[model samples]
Target: MAFLKTIREVGKYFHDIYSGVASLMRGMKVTGSYFTRPGSIVTQRYPENRDTLKMFDNFKGELMLIHDENNLHSCNVCNTCARKCPNGSIEIIYKKVEGADGRSKKILDKYVYHLDTCSFCGLCVPACDELALKFDQKFEHAVFDKRKLTKVLNKPGSSSKTTNE
Candidate 1:
């Protein structure tokens, strides 16, 4: 009686296996048709056709400091982005200067950004209400040396000094 029950269980297992195989074959038939169709293939040559491609507005690439023609960036050196960066890749040096009202104003000294360690998260952008930071669509950041990856986005001699005090 035990042997008969074991044999009955084995027969039931094969019945289920055949059902699964049939289901798989049905799915494969649809895929096989698509494989033969030229329009169904969805692969793009990225490097060769880069000029024709368009990046999404929200796509996070590289962070850049937007500097005006005067070489002054909108960043007040609040260090909001440096503190919020998860990788500690951003370093903002604050320069103390006398404001027109005779009060000391915290100005951006140097903005050191390490592209190698940046996660490309846009958290740093909105944290700056001054709109000093923005993501540039240019993503070709490869460099031969690691030191080259560390960049100061702000132009030299852009900081204006207030002598009102």
Candidate 2:
């Protein structure tokens, strides 16, 4: 009876080893197949194919303020984008000036954007009721100086068309 028990233990050990080996082979089968078929690789050749690379329309790259051909923007300086920014990445500097209509209104002086602190969450885009803020597909942001990441969205001499008019 003892001899029979020893034989059963040996058989069970071999069965456990076989189960482990089978599981390992099942996992390696995928890797081996990919290795054998090199053409199945899906990685894109970047930088080399920069000319042909077209980013999707919905791809979020950088925050931008929409400007017309006249260099005027739609931002009303309502502070909606600044308030909606999760990381405090947006800052709006404005001044109240007397318009030709004799009414004091806010004029956008500067729209400071800190790209380093931005999480690219895109909350600021939709938060603007005026549709002023948006994400542009300009993702190649590699730079040596971190200070260069900071941007002023409004161009020089550009003013908000909403109140200026």
Candidate 3:
């Protein structure tokens, strides 16, 4: 019985070793394929191709609020995006005001976005049921000062449905 237990343990150790070796070979095969392909270079030339360098559609860049031609937005200040963000990157400051219908309504005071804290999770864009938020393809986020990262999305004289009313 002892001999059989020892044999089983040895077999399990060998199995683990084989599995590790198989994974290593698989990874090495991929690396070898890439190494052999000189024309398959994927590195971007950056500033040289700045004018032609287009980011992929799925690339997450700067978070922005979509506004109409008249500087009107659809954000109701519902806080859905702020709540869904894994990091506290979005701060929606809203104020209650009397609407045109005489009912109290909320409007965006400041749509503060802290890009420094953002994880680029893209959760906030979809969480916004109003479809007021989106990510742009402007990848140039390098700034000398960290304070520049914090952005207020609302443009000057911009107003939402409640505020416009």
Compose the digit string of candidate 1's lDDT tens values, residues 1-165.
999999999999998999999999999998888889979776665565568767887767788888777666677677899998999989987778777778888777679999999988778999887788889777688889999989887778776322211
* Cα lDDT for residue 165, candidate 2: 56
Better of 1 and 3 by lDDT: 3
Give candidate 3 regions above 4 Å deviation.
1-44, 162-165
State the C-alpha lDDT per candidate.
0.80, 0.89, 0.88
RMSD of each: 5.1, 3.0, 8.8
What tens-digit string does per-residue lDDT give for candidate 3 at 3-108? 9999999999999999999999999998888789978875655565768887788778899899899889899888999999999999999888887789898788
Clashing pairs in 2: none
Return the top candidate by lDDT. 2
TM-score of each: 0.66, 0.76, 0.70
List model 2 lDDT by residue over 1-165, tens digit each: 999999999999999999999999999999889889999984666655677768899889999999999898999989988998889999999998998889898889899999999999989988999998888888787899999989999999887887755
**Cα miss at 126, model 1 (Å)?**
1.8
Candidate 1: Cα lDDT at 2: 98
**Weakest lDDT window of 10 consecutive positions for candidate 1:** 156-165
- Model 2 Cα shift for residue 109 (angstroms): 1.5
| Candidate order (TM-score) | 2, 3, 1
TM-score between candidate 3 and the true structure:
0.70
